[model samples]
Target: MKRALILAALVLGLGGAGWWYASQRDATGAEADPPTVAVTRGTVERTVLASGVIEAGTLVPVGARVSGQIETLAVELGQKVKAGDLVAVIDSLDQQNEVLKARADLAQIEAQQASNAASIREAELALDRTRQLNRTDLASTQALEAAEATLAVRQAEARALAAQRDRAQVALASAELALERTRITAPVGGTVVAIVTDEGETLNASAETPTIVKIADLERMVVKAEISEADVIRVKPGQTATLTLLGDPSTAFEATLRFVEPAPPGIAQNDAAETTEAVFFNGLLDVENPDGLLRIGMTVQVSILLERASDVLTVPSLVVSRGDGGRSTVRVWDPASRTATEREVRTGIDNAVTVEIVEGLAEGELVVAARDSDTASAAVTMRGRRSVFGF
Candidate 1:
């Protein structure tokens, strides 16, 4: 009886082990199917992301052409100014003296020219009288010759004075321009964004023009976006773009692509071979800022639209897996069979979030976006298909 009871206990243990194994297998089978998302008709766009800075479409730096001390700064920072409005004043005392000298020199040349003209007229009259007397035998040929020489000398003097007068006139004009330069004015209509030089600061402009202020037209703004080298080819002028300031991300500013610079900014200054850094090209976009909300130097995020499609079939970008030969595939789930089958699809633009499905997929169809980890087979399959980057 003891041997029979031991054998029966062993039999019961075997049965319990079999039941546990079967239950685990059933649970694994139930969770093996991957999670799915429905493919639907929607809009999709391909875009390139870039960071940018706000800049004035028309920015001009007001500087002094002549060196002098800043007598008065008329416009302060953030003050609105129109074209030709007085911006600042340099010490005009020296410029005034120079102007006076130029005018006096010009006047002297003019007076000399007038005197020479009178001398020429008197010499002509004397020559005419000498010639008449010589014909009547009253004057000698020597007297006629002397009068002719005097007239020629006076005419030559007049010509010299006329040339001097021209030089004097140019000098006067230049001096007047220098005087005008002392009274700095806005070259463009905009706000005074920066004050580089202050009153009482002497500006030495002999070497270079000293900047007194920076003026920017806030009504229309330009964004200078730094586009990575990889994306530079995709971006082009006339493309639509959207800009959002870091200060206000929710508010988007609509803009248009102006142009992409041929080379990176400051590239000429940098040694190409020695520079071992990522290169980025500048892309410009124009946007209107009538309210003056967009300020210069404001950091911004920019999105350039490369391609777009409307009312097309789309799926989450991750759901579509890329295959060899540039083919795209997605796993379509069959509700009746309770299984997913791989389906080849032709894709259009992908905006990183949603991908446009051109063919091989239908609306309302379910596509496996991801798989459960419990299903090692499905997980491996999904991993292999996700290797494709942005389309």
Candidate 2:
């Protein structure tokens, strides 16, 4: 009786222990299988991310070559203009006076030239008369010499006058050009984005040309993307890119990368190593803005496409284990055996979110995305497909 009783107690204790162990496993969610996601077919793109700004492809600043008070502002801000269109007019009273002075100087020189010519003619006639008289012995040699001297003086005067006339003509042309410069015109066809000098404002262009207005071609734009030095090596000209404006992020603007600067903007080649700050190179991309929605100085998100794979078997990048030998492996799940098998896979493109499986994977086959932990096995999302596991 004692032996049977001891056996019964041992059996009861074993049963209770098993029940407690099973209940604890279920309560902690350790009894649940690991989260698995099916291999999906989708597009995978490898891109370099960057931040950029939208700028006019062709930006030109209209300035005044001659300094004066701005007399008229022809166009307002946001006004569209064509090349050579009148942008602004400066006060031309002083320039007009200068032109008049030049004209007067030219006229005086011309009159002097005419008078010199007349005097030369008279001297030549007198010299000829003296030469004839001397040939006949009617005039002294002194008279002939004096007449020749007078003729030479008059010819020399004519030459001097000719030089003066040339000088005056050049002065007149310069004055006219100065006057024309008072009328500022657009150098390129674009929209007026800025007005630096308003009407009635005095501009001092003696040291540097003062800008009157800013114009930009809004029909097409260039995105100046700042790519880090680490990523600049992968970017190249003629690569396709996509831009999303901060204001309109839902719409993607397609662009073509025009060029990537060899060095950072405003940083000289020799000074690159002198600064401890992070360096970034500019990548230029051309985008068409037919609707005129893109504005200058607008912020943009840039993505430069480096590689792409279409309709390929893909899985979450987290599930992939990479070894030092460049071998990639994944844990494939078998529903019938309730076990996961580790298998090697060839990966084509990895964009971090999804990785393309080139070999050793098939569609509809489940792969362990995360280990069976209370926190990890609850949910797994890959390429818009969600897997939910129950404890």
Candidate 3:
């Protein structure tokens, strides 16, 4: 029996001792079992593993442009708003007072001009009377000239008062604008993600604009994924990606690779010779969130599709062997001759499960995966072909 097994192993070109045992089992029940699969057309995909946090693509902070105490806040956290929506109101008593004071100053200027105009009229009448009296020789020439000079002085005073009124009008306009600033409004349309300040909080805008609320466009969520530098080269814009949140492992969503950052966010300054810090590149992907299931800062597992082939001849990845000089070899099972023949083939993209056969193979042909496990007979079809892994 041992000599017969050796002859069978030599005929099949199976060098493994495990395969010799399987051949014995097949010899007795050759019609019952076979460890071979037919080459078929299928799809294969290669993916790059990554992780990141989900966030809104656009974030807007609602802030106060003027310094004042908050009197009223119209919107709450998570509230949706449109552009120009009134979000908050600051204490505008001071601003209103300024506007009133400016208007009062303008009123005073107008009142003074009224009195000046009346005085100018009286001076003109006196000058005309003086000229008549001088023509009739009843008034002195010096008196007539003095009346003319008084009329000129009154007209200059009226002109000066009118200039003061013009300045007061500009001051009133400025005061009114300051009052408008006290009413805060949303500059963009989005959801109010956060409320930075409560009612009655003092906001100082003299140095910088004080943010009152945070707004975000949550309709589209973006993930800023970090891919290992080793796999970053394979990621590119417009690639396909899928992400699953850490909280819910069962649900997954589709996204499109939007961008790959040119550089790391920031590099640390280090001088250690043996530092083993792992470097990563930033990648961005956008996903639809019409249902709002995704939120900002949510942790997610990401997979980026690097390569894919559809409707191509493929076989189990285990059956393809990698040899020297980047060559690949596979064993073809010929049903008619009942023998194993070694065949070299060109391969394309591959995944953990299958490999794409680009050339040197035809569809519907049997490919050997591995030697059978049972060593009972020459018909070594011990295990099912689909589950067999070829070394």
Please, what is the whole-model Cα lDDT of each candidate in the order they appear?
0.86, 0.88, 0.87
Tell me the tens digit of each residue's lDDT in model 1 across 327-346: 88888999889788888999
Which 10-residue window in model 3 sums to the lowest lDDT? 382-391
Off by over 4 Å in 1: 1-34, 270-275, 321-329, 334-344, 371-391
Q: What is the TM-score of each candidate against the true structure?
A: 0.78, 0.82, 0.72
TM-score of 2: 0.82
TM-score of 1: 0.78
Name the candidate that leads on lDDT.
2
lDDT of 3 by residue, 108-204 (tens): 9999999999999999999999999999999999999999999999999999998999999999999999999999999989999999999999999
lDDT at residue 193 of model 3 (Cα atoms): 95
Report how far residue 316 has shifted in candidate 2, in Å: 1.4
Model 2 lowest lDDT segment of ten: 375-384
Residue ranges of candidate 2 with Cα displaced over 4 Å: 1-33, 266-272, 371-391
